[model samples]
Target: MVTPVHIRPKDDEIYLDCNATTPVLPQISRAVSHTMEQVFGNPSSSHITGLQARYILDNARRLGCEVIGAERGQLVFTSGATEGIQTAVLSALTAVRKQGQVTAGKYLLYGATEHKAVPQALAHWNELLGTKAELKAIPVDRNGLLDLDFIAQHLPHALMISTMAVNNETGVRQDLATLEKVIRQHAPGVPWMVDCVQMLGKGQLQLAQTSIDYAPFSGHKLYGPKGIGFLYVREHAAFTPLIIGGGQEQGFRSGTENLPGIAAMHTLFELLLDREQQVFKPVATLGAYREQLLAALRTAFPTLELNHAFEYSVPTTLNFSVRGVPSRDIMDVFDAANIRVSSGSACSSKVTRSYVLDAMGLDDWRSQSAIRLSFGPATEQATVDAACARIEEAAQALRHSCLLLSDTNEDFDSELDGVVQLRFDAQCCYLVIDRSAREMAVIDPIPQLADRIEKLVACQHYRVKAVVTTEPQGDDSTAAMLAQLLCASGCDAERDNVGWPLAAQADCSTPVDCDVPTDGCLLVGNRRLYRVGSRQPVYLLSSPIEPTAGARVDFAFVGEQAAPQVLESVLGEHTLVCRKWDDDFAIASQLRELKGEG
Candidate 1:
């Protein structure tokens, strides 16, 4: 479970594994360091600091665009080249798929040694594009170059083609022009894409006139800062964004721009290009060291396999697998000897298989036993010599431990700040408030008529985003409760309170303030339920009054006796106990007369 962290040894140790990830250049380091200390303003503001940071990022975008031979605005900054690779691949595939141009039974034609992000993004396209995503690896020659003939054969089923500019392990360069020519001949309409991360400054990538639709590159690979990269979506090529948010990058990408990182990376890209020819001059100084090391490797381990042919490889990378030697033990022995190298380098820990080797049809056994020694612009001849010496020593000591095994980057336990639950268990209604949360709402409200409306919301752990009276009560108690709650909670409380009491009661438990809103309320106990709003109410209850015999309000029973007319009216439609002694029957008849005519 040990992490094979590419720990750059102290000043005493030699580190030639720059391809895995390069250390920040001193110039870039100073830029990022200084910017971090000084440029801390949000770019959204229109003030001096905001405009300064914006200017820095805007210039960075321009430089990044230029480095890729793209138009001034043809580039976009991203988290890293992994995002670049994903964005370009997914966009092209989606655009083609949506237009229904690549008809049935089509597949994504890509080089075998392309970065794993390529296929991973393709998997997403398969799910989201509503089309079967078939990923077919174009065959490669033994030296790790894509076979043009193989591509010609598969172009029929391919919707798009992707090939890396150079192999990370093999140091092999892909002939972009040759690849384009073949695509034009066979699949002319299919877009050609490339991950140019490893190829940028080593030599020229004449992308201006190629059939390449998209290209991805990382800043760190080209002497820029980490956490920043760019994608070159050709000027006219229709594209879509992968990370969609706050309408930034002309609505292509959205997030507060990492201005400092952007400025540092932008400047570095410009620096890399101006010095591109001279920048890699120091690489050639290691020529003798490479020769001596390769010779030593050939003599000491006669059966060792130089996985990549040195003839057509990048001068910066070396990949070899010693026969029957396990890469892990060798890497460990070198770690102790103050030398750093890789077993199988991958961009993301999630996809750590040696995608480069896997593409070349190398079996897991040999591929796992391979180690990569990479370099950068600052690599020195002596450093190379010291690293070569340490590698020889480590390989010999770990010979017995060379078990031909591969391991992935450690999956450390990352504790994400989990979503805080707005839990509510109200035995009695209690207000909870969390000002930091965005969407918070009430579950249940108290039905008490005498409860403090303000206290219901003021005593919470959250700032209520919205309020809903699930059940409406007729009256202003609902309105009053709402007005106080809204004032206390500082939210726009919506009006859901119709005309009903908070709870069903025997007599209308309480009335609402009609000045604001009428809380839906009802009467209980002895009072009759009435449709009361403006004038006299139409009462519907068990008790009756006497105006003539048993009329109420406008008419009543005088002298503590019922009216004769009302009693006669009641007798006609009597269904109650009207005793003769009580004269209740007569009272009912008289009441019936008031009901109309007896």
Candidate 2:
């Protein structure tokens, strides 16, 4: 008998999807709540309340720019990254037209692996708005890095080029300095916009030192409030205003600002500076955590394959796949075990496969099997340990399920009378019957064999009266799982019994809703099944002695060694029949032995 896994409930839910969105820090939450409660005045007003709001907005602008190494009065607040990207592309293209650079159709270039927002925004402005801008997406290598050679050839013909400072899906960071060098040398003053959404809060972006003309940052990705992000424009860079209304954000972006969200974002930047200093000081501590996690996963799943190299990506993020297992199945198991993870970016988790990996030259199968696990300051060692344990157990269950389905057409002969043994590698289950009584019993059936068992029982025309099982040693319990399936099929298999290794009782109860008594006597037609007591079979089907001292046994269907010497010493004279008589168990045993875990 195999025992079901028992998971301990934790005090708080474990979160590993930081790349999607982080939980707002306590300080940021407090500041946002306080501002929402106290400040509701329009920043453009002249009264004291409005002046205070104006001061808050100005302060946020100043500090936010400084954090990204931009000069004062250069940061423009927007709704979020999507709006910021649209504004940046629109402003750059409009400026190119005004500067007499669109004599031929203006061209916009971006990396092949950029977020969907960048390419789609450019397409919308190019085709729908009659901007006459042409768009080109550069290709990335197998490792998801940009192709610089193609950029060098195409840069001179483009009006603006956009690329992300860090990829959102793979956490692969691009060298902005090198890109800036390429643009300045080859394209010569072609405005560049860096989609730095994922880079914010993780590290400082020296935008002023680089040749990048524009950059975008988001608030929620930095653990601040959502619906507020900023765009950084270099001093004296060519640009046009996207919105034309009341002069807010220096006439670049119009409408009243989200004062609370802006202030909250400012506070987040300040706290982020301190957190990065503490969390990544001397060196990044996340690398050590990554090593621990990878080691644990490797120990649990020897065939785990990493999707991204460590040198090209941030340590806080990882993408990997367990060989031969579907990512959706893995995600489901993790979710059921209370571990939060993602099969792809939150934006495209529903797309079935990752376009990011597909662009990186991975085939559909590998892309479908990929899972992303990102870490944050809140992730602890204990959480990692528990999550890994759960993942390993889930993978093991899947492996067993797959193995059970293999060689389905193969048949085996049993050496026992009135018993048919179905062998799956080293494990064997028995079906017992009394032909005259027309009753049958299934012992320790696995879920993978549910259909086969049902078909066989139906073909035999034997009514399954009771289901029985022996104690399981570990997390491979098939008794409870099998009984539930059998019962659900409208078979009158109402009850199940467990034999030796009494600790299995608690470990075997989670997967089913049925009673597993420690000791019981079940009558299946004319055959009686009961636990073997000391020096005696507890009961016989047809006995006159009442079985108090000892029951005269007709025959026994021995699945495995009942106890140390219970079967051998008691039934020494009785003819012992081998429940399993096939080479399937031998093959399974050899496979396990070759793997060194037999």
Candidate 3:
């Protein structure tokens, strides 16, 4: 079992949610502090302190311009990338209107997989100005790559086009070069914006070489201070100011400049650029580290699914879904293990499904079950190894937790003749067979245990005749999946043969394949399983008969919502009461008791 990596500080959270927001590096802390303390004067003050702040701001702007490859173009500082994106998009739309492009209503085209901020910004401007510009969403394929054809076809009519350089959820990179080529070929001189928040430190962007009109970035993503971001607007691009006041930010964004944030970002950018060339090169070993972690996690959970294709996404982020496990459950497991990760975008974490994954055409199982693991330049091999070990341990514990009635206890096992009983989560699945005939049948098998059932069938070399179910009223997805697996495994039993009680006939969401009536017997191999009314059975009964009505019943399966009041009747008194899950603690306590408390 993997334990906590450290114990003293208690802040040993293995942060893997970098795409949301990265930590401010200690290297830049001093710069940020010095600027905040010494350069507190307003840049517009025109005094000694004010001039000093203004000089620092100008220097920061120059460095930002150099980093983004827009030496001649202007850089506007905002609270963060969201404001920058809003400013850029709104300015472009207004410029389009001034150019008389709204004859049929101005259009703003954006990717379906873009950050919510992009579309929301457009909406905000449209509503604020009452311009009533129409918004269009460009679709992406199952791999999360933008459909260039769709964009190219719509480029001519669109007043503005917006897309992200990299997806925050899956880390899927969009090819800006190809996008620029398409725009140049089809619709030249159009405003195009890229949300490069996720790519600030992770991707080496060459905006100066491309036809990108505007690109917004966040300093925090590059290990700089939060509440600081910049917008790069290509020279001679259409522009407007959303927050106009004292004609600050080249008569665009009007606010007291965030001098400290700008200075800190300036220093971090230079360090990050050098770090990009010298140290903390995550791109070099990220893929290999991911493989190592995956291999280790797979040892504990072989059914884990990597959600994104490697070729289409960056090496620093990995999205995975584990079958039969919910994303919330996975998050809880990781949280307990001191490994921090996210189920999806932090902005849309409240939503159960990941719209990004959904737009990529993943089914409900994959999209809702995903967890994102993002690495940073500072992440080391040792940390990755420890986190992977903890992940594997958690996965193993969770995978087998369904069978555990308590931490130390397992289901009671009973074997008689050719019959066996396997209980899990307070539920029971009985296997009955005729060894001579090589025919076997399972009663009330939980679908979550399909793998275990498949393994058992293969090991015993028994041909499954049918799967008899007692409670067919709950979510039938699990039952349906189990049926499909069993049928595909060469079992003669059909998925529709999932037995349902007549009392629950109306309550069952799935169609009842086999209606199990009271006093009715289903033949399996050479044995007969009699469905007695949920009543106490008589212990003294005849046995060793033929396979017909006269045949002796081997077992009585008590189903859900059974009644009380059973006098002795048909089958023998040896009754099997199926277990029911009360709750987590109850099951754990029962398991502990079954294993004998320490």
For model 2, residues 1-598, the per-residue Cα lDDT tens digits are 5455655435555678878887777777888887788877889999998998898898888788778887633889988898888888887777766766652565689888899999998888776556676788889988888899889988878878999888887888887778777778898888888999888756667787777777888887767778989888888886677787988877888898998889888786676556454432222666777777777667656667888888988777888876555576566656655668789889886787788888888765568788888876545567677766766765576445422121132222111236656654335667766666566667666554565566555444556654545443233355555454443243323332442222223322212111222233555554455444422222212222232334344444444434424433334334333333234575355435544585
Note the Cα lDDT for every prediction shown: 0.58, 0.67, 0.69
On a 0 to 100 scale, what is the lDDT of residue 216 in model 2? 81
Task: State which candidate, 1 or 3, has the greater lDDT.
Answer: 3
After superposition, the stretches of candidate 2 with alpha carbons farther than 4 Å from their true spots are 1-11, 103-106, 275-283, 377-386, 389-598
Per-residue CA lDDT of model 1 for 1-598, tens digit only, reads: 6566965347766776778788777778888877878987776669998877777877887776666666633677788878877777678777876786744577887777766778777777766776675778787867788888888888877877888888766778887877788888987777777888888767665566676778887777766677887777776776888888787666666788777678778657767667554445554654455666677566545557777777787777778876544465446555676766777674533433466666677765456567787777556666777766766765565353322222333211111111111211111221223333322333234343112223323333333433333233443554345544553233334333422222323333343212222223222222222222212111111233222232112111121233343333222232232221334565566556666656
Native-vs-model 3 lDDT? 0.69
Query: Higher-TM-score candidate among 2 and 3?
Result: 3
**Best candidate according to TM-score:** 3
Report residue 264 deviation for candidate 3 (angstroms). 1.8
Native-to-model Cα distance after best TM-score fit, residue 246 in candidate 1, in Å: 2.4
- Write down the TM-score of every candidate: 0.61, 0.64, 0.70
Error of 1 at 588 (Å): 99
